[model samples]
Target: MKELKSEVSGFVVSLEAKAGDEIAAGQVVLLVESMKMEVPVEAQMAGTLEEILVGEGDSVAEGDVVAHVREA
Candidate 1:
């Protein structure tokens, strides 16, 4: 499984996938809000969505694993 990480340090805005969702290479998996801006967290590769490590309303740092993708 490949990790899907947050690029910015911020609060989670939304999560679009649950465990076992089929995901594409560039799909938007989650959204984060930082500095009054919304940032998208996209998948690194095509796969089935695995665990969502963080819940909405949680704070995260850069390089933090937000979710996982089991490679297709």
Candidate 2:
């Protein structure tokens, strides 16, 4: 399994992919609000989205593991 980590400290704005969904490299897995801007958290490798560790409106810091992926 690969971990999907947040790139910035922010509040989770939305989830673009759900658990069990197939994901591609660089695809937006979620959106995060930081410094008033929306930043996309992307998958680093193609895989099945295994789990989401954070919900919308949840706070996260940079490098925090937000999700797990079972590599394709």
Candidate 3:
């Protein structure tokens, strides 16, 4: 399993993938709003998105694990 981490401190603007969804490496799992900009949080490797640790509107810091992905 791999952890998808946020790149910046921000609120979760949206989720692009749900649990159990197949995700590609570099695929945007969610968007984070920081300084009025939307930053995509991407999966580091292709895998099944197993869990989303944060929801829309949830605040997250840099490097926070936003989700978990199991290698396919």
Error of 1 at 67 (Å): 0.6
Better of 1 and 3 by TM-score: 3
So what's the TM-score on candidate 1?
Answer: 0.95
Tens digit of per-residue lDDT, candidate 3, span 1-72: 888899899999999999999989889999999999999998889999999999999999999999999998
Q: What is the TM-score of each candidate against the true structure?
A: 0.95, 0.96, 0.96
Overall local distance difference test of candidate 3: 0.95
Question: In order, what lDDT does every prediction score?
Answer: 0.91, 0.96, 0.95
User: What would the per-residue lDDT of candidate 2 be over residues 1-72, giving only the tens digit for each residue?
Assistant: 998899899999999999999999999999999999999999999999999999999999999999999999
CA lDDT, candidate 2, residue 29 = 97
Residue 15's lDDT in candidate 1: 88
Better model by lDDT: candidate 1 vs candidate 2: 2
Model 1 lDDT, full chain set: 0.91
